[model samples]
Target: MTTIMSSALGFASNRRRRAILALLVVEALSLAVISALHLSGVIHGGTRPYNPEAAGIAEAVIGVVLIAGAVAVLSSPKHGRAAAQAATGFAIAGFIVGLTFTIIGGQPVDVAYHAIVLPLLILTLVLSLPKPRDLGVGRDQGPVSKSQ
Candidate 1:
């Protein structure tokens, strides 16, 4: 019975980890598209002047970071949880910053989109913070633990 329970828990944890990884991938892709759209003038916002080159550069940087973060989370046996949580937190912060700036600049549509993204990012962030023990995985006291 104990073995069965442990196996079940491990499976659940793996699923959760995969879910977080998927979220990161989605977020990265979205950022890439957004940057492309802004650069291509498909999405217009007065708050942030559109600069295709700059947007592309920014998108590339964000993509690299997000991908790296996702890889870190997916690969680390013990610190995966923390890596995912930190990635989520970073995403939340980015959304908040973008939203706040857009609102201050009086871009209604941009603000609305940011508001939506912010909540979703927060939700993912919360999910990422769950302890490994909570998922029936062994306790990990790494320096990068998101619970800290």
Candidate 2:
């Protein structure tokens, strides 16, 4: 019974991790699009409502982080876990900074978007952190047996 429950939980965790990876990929693409739009001057609003410079920086940084995070989550037994953790930390920090900026001088729409997107991004980062054994590789115990 306990083994069955453990297996179920393991399966759920892997599913959640994969979902998080998918979310990160989507976010990376979204950021890339936003960055491209900003660069092309196609999605312009105004200085207070939409600062292209700041938006470009945010988009580029978030896109890079999300892509790196997805790659880390997909790979295993390497610097992937550490990279995911770093991406989580970066997302948290970016959320705080964005919130602060919103409170200071951002418009309502911009502030609302930041408030919503930042938390969701943080959630994805949190969900991406999986344990080593959950990856279903092996333990660092004794050598493998040659049994039938």
Which segments of model 2 are wrong by more than 4 Å? Answer: 1-12, 43-50, 77-79, 129-148
Candidate 2: deviation at residue 25, Å?
Answer: 1.2
| Candidate 1 clashes between residue pairs 3 or more apart in a chain or in different chains | none
Residue range 62-136, candidate 1, lDDT tens digits: 666677768876777366666666677666666665655566653455556566656766766776765545545
Clashes of each: 0, 0
Task: Estimate TM-scores for all models.
Answer: 0.67, 0.63
Task: State each model's CA lDDT, in order.
Answer: 0.61, 0.64
The all-Cα superposition gives candidate 2 an RMSD in Å to the true structure of: 8.9
lDDT of 2 by residue, 1-148 (tens): 1211222233234566567777778767867876687667775555444475687678779789878877876874244445666776786676577557656665565566667677777777666555445544355654446671
Candidate 1 off by > 4 Å: 1-12, 45-60, 106-108, 131-148
